[model samples]
Target: MKNDFTLEVYSENAFSVLNRMINIFNRRRIRIRSLLATELEADYKHGMASFKLHTTAEQLERAMHQLEKLIEVERVVRIN
Candidate 1:
């Protein structure tokens, strides 16, 4: 069975932050189906990034854990 997972990451608006997030997927050899980034707050430029990937439950959990560990990531949420 395949599961589609969405990772919502809140972090600073910077290219390094985005690059780090993409590296997580690359290192896992997971292909991201979609990636969206937007500013959450205008003043601070807090960014929200959503990544969609289809994979097994175990891999999804691992990916979430890795993403949460990033210093720039303020929060991580898993979406069905």
Candidate 2:
């Protein structure tokens, strides 16, 4: 049951954090459909990244849990 899911990640401007986040899906061979980034704060190290991809619910759950564990990640939420 693969369906589209959007993951919104609130994180700092480490940049590396973004790579790690993408690696979560890349390691599993899941291709991200799209990605958008926006600045949330005037300071340098704060922003949000939105990722859209298609995957099974079970896999998404695991990926979300993993995303939350990253030190730079402030929050991770599903948009749909």
Candidate 3:
């Protein structure tokens, strides 16, 4: 049921945003298979966090929705 998601965080405070996202997963008890953050090569000023979690589809959707509401987050989308 779990899926991969690519999150592009646009704020200057990218580290803070990543921390908050980790907290979100922790609080929800979602076990993450892989969580990686990398600076976007095209947009040198921005960063992207890629997450692969072990969770249900509904739970993933809810988490993505919540992520989109964060101030430091730019966009949340499930990757194919």
Candidate 4:
């Protein structure tokens, strides 16, 4: 079953990494409901990208795993 999710992805150069992460969802045919990307701190060395997605739990787990595999992605958190 599909459900709504709030996901936060922390990474380096969050803006740049957005494309790659979006591509993962695109390939899966999952639509992104909303997105917010910004540097986590003033240093710009780290960033956080938040997204609202509608998808099955299985797909969510797979996507999170793939996101973690990314070189720039520091971690992924499911807020809800």
Candidate 5:
């Protein structure tokens, strides 16, 4: 089943983090439809990294798990 997820990533530079994310996606052989990482409007206390992704439910869950393992990643959620 296809699933759309909004994952809020807390990392330093969105650019570097995105590279790692892309590597993971390539390793997993999952194609990303669209991804956006924007700085949070709040202060630095919130960290500031957000992304939206569209993929299969299984792929999404697996990707989330992998992302959680990365030290740069603080948290992840499957938003509605």
Candidate 6:
């Protein structure tokens, strides 16, 4: 069975940050259903990225783990 997952990532607004996130999904051949990115605060350089993806629970967990390991990533949460 497949599960729908929403990942919220907080990180610096750097190209590398977005690249790393996309790479994680690409490496696993997972397609993102939707992606939204916005700046966290006007005074800060941090941003938030939200991604909706459909995949197995195991793959979701693995992706979450990899996201947390990135230096640019401050936090990661699964909305559903």
Winner by lDDT between candidate 6 and candidate 3: 6
Give the poorly placed runs of model 4, Cα more than 4 Å off. Answer: none
Decoy 1 TM-score against native:
0.89
RMSD of each: 1.3, 1.0, 2.9, 1.2, 3.0, 1.0
lDDT tens digits, residue span 26-68, model 5: 7887766666666654654334344556668788788879988
The superposed Cα distance between candidate 5 and the true structure at residue 64, in angstroms, equals 0.5
What does candidate 2 score in Cα RMSD to the true structure? 1.0
Candidate scoring better on TM-score of 1 and 4? 4
lDDT of each: 0.86, 0.90, 0.72, 0.91, 0.67, 0.92
Off by over 4 Å in 1: none
Candidate 2 Cα outliers beyond 4 Å, as residue runs: none
In candidate 4, the residue pairs with backbone N, CA or C atoms under 3 Å apart (3 or more residues apart, or in different chains) clash, namely: none
Q: Select the stronger candidate by TM-score from 1 and 6.
A: 6
Candidate closer to the true structure by lDDT (higher is better), 2 or 4: 4
Can you give the TM-score per candidate against the true fold? Answer: 0.89, 0.93, 0.77, 0.93, 0.66, 0.94
Give the local distance difference test score of model 3.
0.72
Give me candidate 4's TM-score against the actual structure.
Answer: 0.93
Off-target runs (Cα >4 Å) in candidate 3 are 1-13, 41-44
Error of 5 at 40 (Å): 3.7
TM-score, prediction 3: 0.77
Angstrom error at residue 10, model 2 = 0.2
Per-residue accuracy of model 6 over 1-80 as CA lDDT, tens digit each: 67789999999888778989999999997779999988899866899999999898899999999999999999999999
Please write out the lDDT profile of model 4 over residues 1-80, one tens digit for every residue.
99999899999984558899999999998779999988878788898889999999999999999999999998899999
lDDT of 2 at 53: 85
